[model samples]
Target chain A: MDETIEGSFQIIGGNFANAGEASMQLKSKLVELGIDEAIIRRAAIATFEAEMNVIIYAAAGRLQYYITPHEVTIKIDDMGPGIENIELAMQEGYSTAPDWVREMGWGAGMGLPNMKKNSDEFKIDSVVGEGTTVKMIIHFS
Target chain B: MKLSSIVESISLEVKTGKNNLQNDVTGVYISDLLSDVMANSKEGNIWITLQTHLNIVAVAGLKNLSGIIIVGNRQIQQDVLQKAESEKITVMSTPLPAFEVAGKLYQLLNG
Candidate 1:
């Protein structure tokens, strides 16, 4: 718990088959580190939501995590069309995902809110034509 | 109650993770939305949904759900069943809709 642990995972967009792999890996890593079960669950949920966002919207992305004694930090950086309206995107049940994605039981517009709810601290940055970056921190106490 | 007991009582079809039928059912969560399940489902809860996609397996695994009940006898893909097996998450199908399945499960668990 004293030393810092870090890791990174690649996320391929539109790969529904492999979606949430990064989050799953992160969850396993946290479990291996012997973190608290509740903390691990929150971290896992936040990271999974971020991973899904990249898969559903971006072309590709990287999920990186840093685990310290006090907190677990997750960052997702992707290459895809960014959100035009952060406010609207942050609202619950507001999604721009196409019908195909909706048909697959996703795109309910709860991803961002879920991430924020699970994380002790959350931040999102995006450019209209470029991409989006999401950062979340879960405190371990 | 154990998952195998519920399956037997309800006549649900076992698709995969047959060996995992011994898992103890903590509760039931009915949702087709992946994020909703991710956000709300507790560990050991059984998820009931109409989704047959591979990501359902991922959600079940992430939440550490006891199992998945695919209601309405939805046609689950072969790959989905395989993934569920690998994840060690029991997935069953039933001809009944979500409402009926939920009702039966509620009685068994709370009755």
Candidate 2:
């Protein structure tokens, strides 16, 4: 186990071309830091889904990564139209994305569920008309 | 199965990452949705999709996929090809739709 390792990244809304960049970067960092490959894949998948949520739904956001010897934690806060129904939003195959977003091979209503599935710990909070934030944690052991 | 053999069997056009033809293919994953692939795809699987975008390359690289085969003869963007080459993610295509291509690949891999 090592000391705490931390980093942050910015995400721009509607930026489909660069949507996965942050997750890729974080995954590379985890690889460089020599974390377990399985754990890193989970974290990377969770982060990518969260990042895509920001791009498709939010106007902008920040993704923060915190790593300790025992676990890896990811925090994402976005400025967008917050979810009105968290339960409905959590359902698989439920999506509000416009047709255009769907055309890009995303907005399948799988993003949030996939994120939750990949995280050892997951929590989300949102305020209608304000914004949304997601936190995901993965154990290193 | 190696990517080259799959391409040869399927008669796919190699779009990029030609140098990576020797990458091993453990199985196949057929999907157009990005998150589903991210969550369910196994490493070394060959991805079959109609999506032609740069993010697919990123996803394939992230998942350590053996290669990507775009179906339906979709016109893949140039930037997507460049990204695949740089990442060494083998990319190929076929005029056949997803089902036919997937069937042929499966037969080649299993038969």
Candidate 3:
């Protein structure tokens, strides 16, 4: 592997009906590119978590995948009411998602932790009223 | 039993994929939560869900699931059905609720 590729996905906020479209497409593309299964699963899980966060909390966002011979990087940028407490949000089973989202079986607050666990590197930036952006990287061998 | 047999045995009314039964379902998993299913489901299981959303199909695709069966008499969205068809993943709907659908699938798979 001595090459690289990049893909970008636009995540629409409040689009419960159409979410995950981009992530799925990216997974297919990676499969076509012969990306490793572990790396592809990590990328898929990260994208899924990010997409859900954008849909559940943010107004809108964009996701980008940077693939290289050594590793893959994912970035999610969103515009919405940002996290007031980043540390708390990172804790598992802690969620601020409303009743409806919970009723449908999300908001377990596993999104961030799962993203971090599945990725080789993880970083999150947020402000009270600004927004949230998650950057994650997973190395390939 | 074939996937078509599971459908016939359970009396699952497929809103789509009537001809795509050539796809085999080795197992089945039932869940309404998109996130949980994506995380836990083994590949090639027919995912049964009542919460019909476009993400259901995506999760199935990610997990390489045989197909998704929407239960509880819900109407499969046009866009979702189209996506499923395009992806060659079988999509179907059942009037049965989640638990009932699960039981039926179990009986069919065992039968």
Candidate 4:
């Protein structure tokens, strides 16, 4: 395990077409770093869910990662209409994505649950009408 | 079944990479959305969709997908084709809809 590996991506809002870029980059990088596939998939799921939130919900956001021998941490911060109910939002099958988003076969509301399910540690903070911030960590241990 | 068989069944045109259709495939998935594909696709699965985008190749790379079959006779963006070529991702297209391709693949593979 490399003691130091880091990556950062600036995910844009409303660019639903390119929403998965960051996670894709992260996945390739992890493979190059020789990280475990399961670990890579876990981090990818969390980061992708958070990134998509920024694209569909937030106006824009940044996905930043901090890597170490022990863990891979991903943080997504977005500026959008904040969630009114984090608890309900965390539940599966809840989404507010636009018609086109759904037409593309997404917005099924499985994003949050899948993110949480894949990560070792997950945190969410949001203020209605303000914005949202998400943090996820997956330890190699 | 080999991609050659799928092509014959669906009347698909091997727009590029004819050598690619020679690859063996075990299953098929039809989806336009990228994330859903990322989560569900297994290696050696041929994906059929109407989505023609650059990122689709990236998703195929991550999932280790066998190839992509674009529906609706959609014109694949040039940039997307270039990336697919570099990645060695097989590309095929059919005028059929996503549902028909899915059904055909299911029939061939499941039978």
Top-lDDT candidate index: 1
TM-score of chain B of 3: 0.88
- Clashing residue pairs in candidate 3 are none
- Model 3, A68-110: lDDT tens per residue? 8777788989998999999978865567787579666677567
The models' CA-based lDDT, in order, is: 0.88, 0.87, 0.80, 0.81
Candidate 4: pairs in clash: none
Cα TM-score of candidate 4: 0.56
lDDT tens string, model 3, B29-109?
887777678788997788887755566677888999877887766655577788877777778777778898887667766
Model 2: chain B TM-score relative to the native chain B:
0.95
Can you give the DockQ of every candidate in the order shown?
0.07, 0.07, 0.06, 0.06
Candidate 1 residue runs with Cα over 4 Å from true position: B1-111
Report the C-alpha displacement of residue B79, candidate 4, in angstroms.
Answer: 45
TM-score of chain B of each: 0.96, 0.95, 0.88, 0.90
Rank by lDDT, highest first: 1, 2, 4, 3
TM-score of each: 0.59, 0.58, 0.56, 0.56
**lDDT tens digits, residue span A74-141, model 2:** 99999999999999889765678875786677876678989999999999999999999999999988
> Rounded to one decimal, what is candidate 1's iRMSD?
9.9
lDDT of 4 by residue, B49-101 (tens): 77665677888889878789988766666777888888888888888888888
